[model samples]
Target: MRLRRHSLPEPRIQSKHTGMLQRFYNDVVLALGHGCGSSHLAGWRRCPPALTIICALTLGLSCKVHAQAAGNDADNANNTPAAPTCLPDGSGSLKARLSGAVQAELVWGNEGTECTGAVRPDGGIRVRFSHKDGVDGGRLVLLFGIAALREGQSAKALPVNVTVIREGLGEFYSTQGDNKCTLDEVRQEPLVGIPHRSRSYRIIARGFCTHPARAVRGNGVILLPRFDYVGRIDFDAEDKDETLEGGAMTAQGRMKQQ
Candidate 1:
């Protein structure tokens, strides 16, 4: 028998869905800039951009559905207002099953026992992690202190290190070991960078602790890693140098720990 010939499928045409996605980001940036709080995120689900992306991904696989899923990306770009660089303070976002919201407030680390009443670094940065809950759900707080930070440390600045020293692994899951976890494989990017007019630094840190339990999906155990928090973080080190609570400071970063 002779083999049949097949032609490749054409690309999908454009649609309004593309603009919907842009609007989503616009709203998100706007919400973050205004300090909308975690409550504003609930609207993301009802946001049309999600459905537009889903349609583009799953249904668009087939050439027949491609055109239907196509969206006009330019439509929204032309209509939306100019979005300024959003530098959040004490509030951020989390990427989870539902894209949870996080509130990472930056405070003096002197209160925690782990610090041992040791003085914060002069021109150095140190932070500690604690589980936090928002109106919608849970997030993390970065109790931190920065001292003697020179203006030049902005670029090539040292990694602002923080360790999760909590022993409450059992609180979220059945097993333990996630306690005393450190941020590993962290990726950082400066948004409103320091050493500049902007006050915050955009950074991403990964390697959140794995859940203490596993799931059995079939004959083999299904690997279910828990508490892997990742998102953006905005850190500001202008004040509170060499002293805890001596001056005011704030933190809101989105990090990814994979």
Candidate 2:
């Protein structure tokens, strides 16, 4: 028996889909910038850039289908915008099953509890994890306080986590943690911040007793620095003087991974 040489089949090129595919690619590009909520995506005239990106990605991928009818169905679904459904707060908790829409998937420990309280321009937010009193074994809970910002401005300005103590309480504040988060850009004309003008925020993660809790018993404070944001953090003493700025007035910085 003799072995025969065989040529491999050439890759299929779909000429009819060329024009359609190019348009699809453009949509993907637009969606990428928006999905990440980059500063460049925020502009006048349009739906949220992030949402636009989701639609583009869905359509682009669906167009890969060899069957024209199937591809068209996918494309139509991507192009159709679902009715608006709002979350209590515009956190990443919103979910829509449409082919194209803004969405997020959170894994445990990765997505901490989003605290209900927030810090003011002059103040901050306090988060508490409840525990049973006198319990030798206890579980620690983690929470996240996301900062809200202008459509594009949200991506700018590094977020810093500072620990501010008042008498006996610790408070945490985020750059975008407040009612300011819910403000509508289309309805509200806001001031643009000057570059390099940064605000320091404080976030307090404290553990307290919930079972018959009274008189601040069995309470402890765990200060995790640099809760969120991507940038450099400085953990240093506010003052060199050993007299005034001891552990009480002393400040320290910790790095938070993005």
lDDT of 2 by residue, 148-220 (tens): 3222133323222222222212322222222212211111111223323432222212121112101111223
RMSD of 1: 26.1
lDDT of 1 by residue, 161-253 (tens): 222211222111111122323344343344464435663343333333233221111111111222222223323432333212222111111
Winning model by lDDT: 1
Candidate 1 lDDT for residue 202 = 33
Off by over 4 Å in 2: 1-114, 121-155, 162-258
> What TM-score would every model get versus the actual structure?
0.24, 0.18
